[model samples]
Target: MSKNTQAPIPDSYPMTGGDGDYSYSRNSFYQRAGSEVAKSIVDNAIQENLDIKTISSSVSRNSFYIADFGCSVGPNTFTVVQNIIDAVQKKYQSDGLSSQVPEFEVFFNDHASNDFNTLFASLPPPRQYFAAGVPGSFHGRLFPESTLHIAYSSFSIQWLSKVPEELFDRNSMAWNKGRIYLTNAPNEVSEAYAAQFAKDMKNFLDARSKELVAGGLMVLTALSTPNEIYHFPVSPEFMFDLLGSSLMDMVKDGIISEEQVDEFNLPVFLASPEDMRRCIEKNGCFIIERMELLIPLSSINAQACAMNIRASVEGLISKHFGSEIIDELFGRFQKKLEESINLVEEIMTKRRNQLVTVLKRK
Candidate 1:
């Protein structure tokens, strides 16, 4: 389907992947860096009997379907699914429950526009496993009602569709050259983003609520910021600004046009814990069991963080700046990111990390 025709694919890129380009799935930086935090969440959910108990009680032996919403093509998916299986097996074993080993149907979902060929090719054999791709946004229904026992999404869901054009006036003015959606942009712009997030999240929870039997479980790990901050810039937009500055410098040097940079808008949105909690409560299905902040040491260092910043923006730079100038732009962009990181580090010691939440249906 065409990009315009498709509903917003949360956490998906505006463009398709090239041959052998599995950057979204293969970037071990996020998984390796975030594994410990992920493990703790799985361990806690098992220990506390968080949401699993609810689903386990309702479902027959070997009949439960466990879904990994937004499961990118990478080692993270395997790691998480294995962890869930181990947790469930241990639970059954300890209880002396002679129930047949649960048959797991793992649905690795993402946008239809995602690189499924790469994802499928990367997947290991499904010994005692059934795998399928559920394309489209998790915010919309992808599975039937009361079918899923567990759902998990990691390092995803923070992305929104491209910034809506109505956020700016029609006059085509450069209001905030270094800011996201104009530093002075109407609160409606921010609210528009916030409202979309709430709507999408509600759709996700509501759909899952219908699909999950009573007491089903959901674990979500995504990039979140403090609510009180009120105006913490979206990470992608920040990176975009960094890149835009570099592009503008090039334009001044007659390397590109102001129109080129003006045409771009990074697709990302970092929700806050409070925002998420409010949405969950509104859905009235899942109750938060545990929520923890996980900081990646690699991201904490200014230099390493800078590299990640570059990686995140690399695709957009290549698309907007053109292939010929991409390498030069990246070099300048990397230096600028390093400088930005240093400035940020001087005032802030560590990068705010992932927020891991485990919820049980109420």
Candidate 2:
């Protein structure tokens, strides 16, 4: 944990409730943003010529073990899980095993403090698969070794286990003052964030490698920035800049102190495809089956895009700064986003990219 963090960093943030304070459940913006990328991963996996017999041989039991890492309180997760289950069932039928109905054990995993009640209660009644909640960080082991057959995560791995600690030390050149995230920070700050992401990805892949049986599959979707473009008009990093500027505005207005901004750094990183490929190769535990950049986030309108960003970070912000300032802060954020969009109307038509990665356990 960073020494400057006002609150202890959880493995990930939680989104729950339909009230005005926690509107993630009611808002469909995030689901809309991630839907295409997730569907592509599932569809592409099904299209692959997977040997059902070989995959089934690795597991000892008749039941299939599936886990959704970082399954927040959102409806999109349900659709993604169903798609995976359907693909598995289709493979079984194609192998002339349609007579057998294998029990499906689905696990929803997130940080310890995630709102398990809301997530579980919202489960589809009379569900086809057995459901259970597994609370732990995906950066470490959460299940017994060789116990899982399939793992899926969408729009989640971008979050680091915690903010880079070097950013907290006053003497460190990586101290990310005047910015809450690594959006427009100096070269040193960006490098520090990349280092932390590499470490976390290593831990994530190592743990998943141990838990999943040989030949098991893992699919992940995450936000990424364009390498050629420093600051694209409609990128995730640009949305982050709007957020950082909002906090600075509060500081100027005496609504919040500048030290508060300096002390807080977001525990998130937008990894590029090259970064992921390098990490996977270094781990040597998983074979990269497919890697592609999915739908650009800029396809969504600026207002909806802003809402998607708000749904993701509101929980983390409210936790640090009290719930009192939530409405005012986002209200300012929405207006600023509109201004930014109008300024770059011509360039805004381009895509804001995301990465979809597929790996098989070796």
Candidate 3:
């Protein structure tokens, strides 16, 4: 296993809860689409590499633990886990171990503030596996040693444990005075963010390596920055800046202080494929089973697009800038979006890789 990481975990909040028009449950179309697009790759990975004999022999007996990290309140998480269960069941039957079919248990993990009530309430009426809510940072230890057999994460893990401490210091070049993220920032600001992402990914790998059993599998689909890109405003790199423009507009109108905008930055970083490979190899405990860039399957309109960003970042923004400004903030965002609505259609479609990867515990 890689050395234990001492990086601080993010004090992040959950996605906008409940099934409102702008709530995460209603607006996570891109995430849901990414899961659908990656399912076949995941199923094939499990079918070809699950090592059922070793799992049956060496892992916990008669029970398999699967975890979905960064799971927000959803029917999407439920459906994804069910798909995984079906694939695993198929593997067992193919290997003639149907007689010993293990009981499946799923752990839906997210931050402590995630809406467990909504998540549990939305659970499928007749789910095959037992369900549990696991609350904690995925970048740290959340499960018992050698407990999880398969770990799945879809369109999450972009968040840094926390925004880099350097970004907020006025004396530092990485202060990121006006922007909400490092995407279109100065060289030093971008470098500081990259350094923090490496730290968070190290901690994530360290924690998962310890949680997963021998021959365990981990499957993930993450929002990623492409190797070559010049356009694509909807992708995260430029997307938040669009909102930041509104925040600056509010600053001009004396609605909020520039300092408040300066202090607020999203704790997210889109990993490149090279970033994933470097972190996994340095961890030295897993085999890189698969790593490929794929596009999301679903599509939506420009208004759904603005709400999508609102749904994901609402909670975080509300916490920092006060809940009072939310309506005004997002209203301005929508107005700005309409002004230039001829941008990218699907989220991150033009230039994002949307990296999908599978790793096996060694």
Q: When superposed on Cα atoms, how far off is each prediction in RMSD?
A: 4.6, 2.6, 4.4
Q: What are the runs in model 3 whose C-alpha is more than 4 Å off?
A: 1-10, 228-234
In candidate 1, stretches whose alpha carbon ends up further than 4 angstroms from where it belongs are 1-22, 50-54, 57-61, 125-128, 171-189, 230-240, 298-325, 341-349
Give lDDT tens digits, candidate 1, residues 1-362. Answer: 21222222234552324333325443346545665567867766865654445666667765767888766555567778778877776766676664655777778887786667776777777545777888888877888778887788887676664554443333333222233443244565566667767777878888888877777778888876655253444332455456667777887888887655545545556677888889888888787888876664443444444455554445555655667886677677767777777545532335555678888866
Q: lDDT score of model 2?
A: 0.76
Best by TM-score: 3
Of 1 and 3, the candidate ranking higher by TM-score: 3
Look at candidate 2 and tell me the lDDT of residue 77.
71
Clashing pairs in 2: none
Q: Write down the TM-score for model 3.
A: 0.93
> Against the hidden reference, what TM-scores do the models get?
0.81, 0.91, 0.93
- Look at candidate 3 and give me any clashing residue pairs: 10-161
Give the whole-model CA lDDT for all candidates, comma-separated: 0.64, 0.76, 0.82
lDDT tens digits by residue: candidate 3, 231-285: 2355656667788989999999999998788877888878778878988899999
Would you list the rank order by TM-score, best first? 3, 2, 1
Q: Clashes in model 1: which pairs? A: 146-211
Worst 10 residues of 1 by lDDT: 1-10
TM-score of 1: 0.81
Model 3, global lDDT: 0.82
Q: After superposition, how far is residue 105 of candidate 3 from its true place, in Å?
A: 0.8
